[model samples]
Target: MEDLIEDKRQQTGEINLLDIECLGLINPRNTYAITILIYFLENSQDWSVRQEAARILGEIAFGNSEAINALLKVVRTTVHDELAASPDFTPNLESNSQIEFKQLLISSKILHNKPNLDFRASESLYKIDPGNQEAIKALINLSFWHISAWCTHDDAIELLKQIAIGKPEVILKLKKQLQSNNESVRGASAEIIVTVEPNNQEAINILIELLCNGGEILEETQDFFTGKRILEHIFKAIVNLPSPL
Candidate 1:
């Protein structure tokens, strides 16, 4: 495994999906396995390899603080890099302005240049630490801002529902996002809340409003499709809600 990791470092084609799968099939509790997976996750040039490493780390390194911290670093760095690559990004801005710019860019990036390593890392972090605020926030951003087909908005929302089960703070954050000006953000947030808290009248009301009145926030050319997607989320949530007394 160490040799494979080295070969991956020196040559991208030397390692492939089979190598990652073999690594995953090893005893997850093996310390060397954790170390090798972390190395691949942090150093590999191949995003797919890194994503697999992240997934395995979550499965094996459940309570390992070192592994959790590494996943956190990946999420933070990936998100910052994605935002920095935005066309509207400006360097040397004031601290507050930079922060605001990040928030704005989070909701408006139509094209995601980077792979979904950050999403995979954040999902792993959630598996390790459900209460991790950074992971929850990253998932929220991916749910709303990321428009890729590989990592759909529903993927993030489904994960958030699991994380929000007993985490009030996560629920609160999702509820707050329901009020976001971005219609997609609101719809995504509501979907999570309703899925987690079926009796959440506020979230149910918002879903109804989004279904009836929400515009296509995903794209102008794909308005009908995107709006239909949001409606699908609403219908699914409503169907799953408890029957009237």
Candidate 2:
């Protein structure tokens, strides 16, 4: 079967044979299938084939370090900004060729939006091991738009509480972002700070500063209140903080 695949590759210059092989190997119990997929991933000339191999690797590898390592190798080598000579590079191609091109396009968009394949790999790793700190930190390094929604949720609040206790430096990173010239960055930093440390004097002082000398405050409309009064939220947080001794 391996020789047949190599012969087909040499004749057709495509990975259709390997694609079929990968489909058969999707079962988690098939270790040899995983090994073959990793081989294709590492050595396939066509990146689209490599990408399909990556997806399957993420699925079947689960918590397997060997699988994770192969995927991470792909993640490291897969340049995100790679673009075809034309956006519509599928012209005059066979069905399999078109499929491969489409896969390449998907891979490009995934990397472009998420910033890197490593981030995607980390997400997959996290799915495999929820407590993987490396995965957690990798996800945390993503942009606010990528990693968080605008509104606070119970899970997010709980996570913040946990991070405050175990990894206070994660909270401190927000303080560094406060110095950013971008108002969105500054606003988000202040907002999360207040959420995490409502009683913290330093956080309160920063919020007060934002309220007094505002550039770009996050605006939210709650029950007919439509204004950029982030300071009010800060004030309310201060008011709600437990009274001092």
Candidate 3:
């Protein structure tokens, strides 16, 4: 795979395989080689390559030292305008001192924009222990959109609430979205009920309120759970903890 990357990196124009090299390192089919590549990316002075490497590491969110360091740089980078990302972020030059063309931001965008791309996190902590809190915590910061509609009902909800505690912006939007007039929002609301409670009392009161209120969500194509099961999930939450986290 790397040989393929090397061949393409020597391209006269934009390196066609630049992204492939980064992706391979992100979630490589091989471990030792990829780890070395990741370290190399982390140490590279070129912000372009560093940015791409950071994005791939961010996807892991497992806080492995090297991966965590790379991702921390990205979290900081996202906040900066022309963030002093890579110490060597310079334009490429051709033989005549003419500016050459090559940009790593494009590749970085794909990886960062889609943190839950799944394949990237393979063989890491997420693969071994799906419930690692650190990774979930990182997702709260970087990957809310993907988590918002994921199939994990209760766990997804909890993660959202945890995130909301720190980021009111995300919570307000998500909660407001929960009751959005859209049918999908109505259905998707179920995904977070277990996880969106701001506090225990609020969670408990909402559960009680929902049960009495039928957990009604605009009465769309389907009645929430199964039409007959309007409040099954919420009711279960009420019955089990009576006050979710």
Candidate 4:
């Protein structure tokens, strides 16, 4: 059966790859299936093939350490594009060298971008084992990345809240963030708690204290992390809820 699936995968047919995935679902706990799926995930040239392999790996190896680690590997993979690795400073360089030099001189940057696979893997880890500290940590690490235009910042925050649910250590981590001297960190921590546990008294108190002390960002300041709109909503949410006592 493994040989047949491998044959199908080598054919480079989407339908054939999907058939192998169905087999994975049928025998999620099979060692052969896990091995095959991981192979395709790491080595497949086709993005769809790699992506499906990852999706199935998460579902099948949901709580298994090896499976989780494989997913983490997928998420950890990064494609590097050197903006200006070697600056052409020779006088005899081609005409385009000057243009490239101008661009490089302005800013030589190597931007690190995480793939969607990481998002899927992190979510699957939490889904399979919400209490796994490593999974939660991975999700937190993912959150630190700059969200693309296609994805809203709120999406990451919501995902983080999901990680915090039923995880006391995660909740405590957020609470600690709330104590940071940085207002942005405190504001973010409070906002996260509001979503994770809306009725939590500590969350409410933090929101209230932030309102009284730090106040809101001025109209002129366009800071994304320490804005007034989120605090306004949090305050309203706490006000509308009954007392915790």
Candidate 5:
């Protein structure tokens, strides 16, 4: 196995297209085993080779979400911040250098973003209806390692909207967070979704429920993270909720 991997790597270095073809044949769908493929996809000195790797990974990951996320991590880490300062936001140009800069924004997020792949993988596995233990195990690892960074309250709320559409049960998790003691987490958790889309009835209902009937949540005036209107937004949400009391 290592011999085959070595040949593929060496072949790419030598600019051997035949070797590239062989590598593709060897690992048509098994990116997990084709670590050599990712190595080239990620770190080849040649832009053409790297581009080819990126292209192939895109195709490979179409059905296997694990492959997709693995590639996403590569994209995230290799993202060039200096180049991404003003993202194109052009609506579908995947190779825009601005994407490299977007990683900076991911770190700047006001709330936490968990990319560890645990939650991601579990969710993907469930979506595929794989119905087994291996998928759960993969998801757990994915979460712990990759997706566990902070996001803007905007990003979190946007994600919640996406989640709310597919899995209303996930709203239950957001519902629990609306009652949190930490002002930032709770405020961001509660208002993030409604602020972005404004049609989150369940989320809005939970926010109302928290403000009117939930326990006393102390307010802290310190600015913990920059650039997020998480708490101020939460206060607004509180005032906006209709009262039965």
Candidate 6:
């Protein structure tokens, strides 16, 4: 496995597609494979290879502390890197008219800057530790910025719904996010809370508020499109409610 990874790195500056395909055929539980996978996950320059390694580790090393720690590290490092690259947005009295435009621009920058590695690692962490706080937090934060691109927002909310079941702390956090100043964050949180507790009046109310006041809340044209996407989620959640609002 090491030879294949190294050869691909030396030849193509990345693991070859065929080599990755072949590697996937190997037994995930092989101890030697785990060591090599972890090495590549941390050291490989190729993000796709690192992502695959993280995924395999999650599948094979269910209770392994070393594997869990590695996944956590990936989550932390990727998030940090992405945030550092995000465009800063600051509006002054003179620039008030540009606030909405800048918000849309910043959101676009963040969405494109995020790597798939963090999402993969977060998913792996959840696999190994069902209610891991870091994993849940990572997903929630990703949901807030990603919107509909790559289905990231939907996927994160789905996982959060799974984690929130029988987990009061997770539910509590979702409830708190309902009050987030960011419209996307509030929408994502409300979606999760409503999914978990269909009759959650607070969640339902927030969704309704977003639908009714989205244009006023998000003044820019592009931002309203974002709000429109959130409205789609809101309508879906409302439709799925066991009881009507």
lDDT of 1 by residue, 1-245 (tens): 75766678587755454454466557455566677678888777555778888887777777778889889888788546645655556656666966777856553542342436777888889877757889888888888733454354667777788878888898898889877877767777888888778888988888787666645433442656655666677778777888989
* Residue ranges of candidate 5 with Cα displaced over 4 Å: 1-8, 11-59, 62-153, 192-228, 231-245
Ranking by TM-score: 6, 1, 4, 2, 5, 3
The deviation in Å at residue 98 for candidate 3 is 26
Higher-scoring candidate on lDDT, 2 or 3: 2
In candidate 3, which residue ranges exceed 4 Å CA deviation? 13-65, 76-78, 81-135, 141-201, 204-245
Task: Give the count of colliding residue pairs in each prediction.
Answer: 0, 0, 2, 0, 19, 0
On lDDT, the stronger of 2 and 4 is: 4
Error of 5 at 63 (Å): 5.8
Per-residue lDDT over 12-34 for candidate 5, one digit per residue giving the tens place of the 0 to 100 score: 74434345445555666555433
Q: Give the per-residue lDDT digits (tens) of candidate 4, residues 183-215.
A: 545655666777767777676776677667534
> Model 6: C-alpha RMSD to truth?
6.6
Give the runs in model 2 whose Cα sits over 4 Å from its true position: 1-26, 43-52, 74-116, 144-245
Per-residue alpha-carbon lDDT of candidate 2 for residues 25-104, written as tens digits (9 for 90 to 100): 54463566567777876666554566566556656666777777765553344333333323544444566966887877
- Of 2 and 5, the candidate ahead on TM-score is 2
Q: Kindly report the root-mean-square deviation of model 4 from the true structure over all alpha carbons.
A: 6.4
lDDT of 4: 0.60
TM-score of each candidate?
0.72, 0.41, 0.34, 0.61, 0.37, 0.73
Candidate 6: segments with Cα more than 4 A from true spot: 1-28, 78-115, 145-150, 221-225
TM-score for model 3? 0.34
What CA RMSD would you report for each candidate? Answer: 6.9, 10.2, 12.0, 6.4, 12.9, 6.6
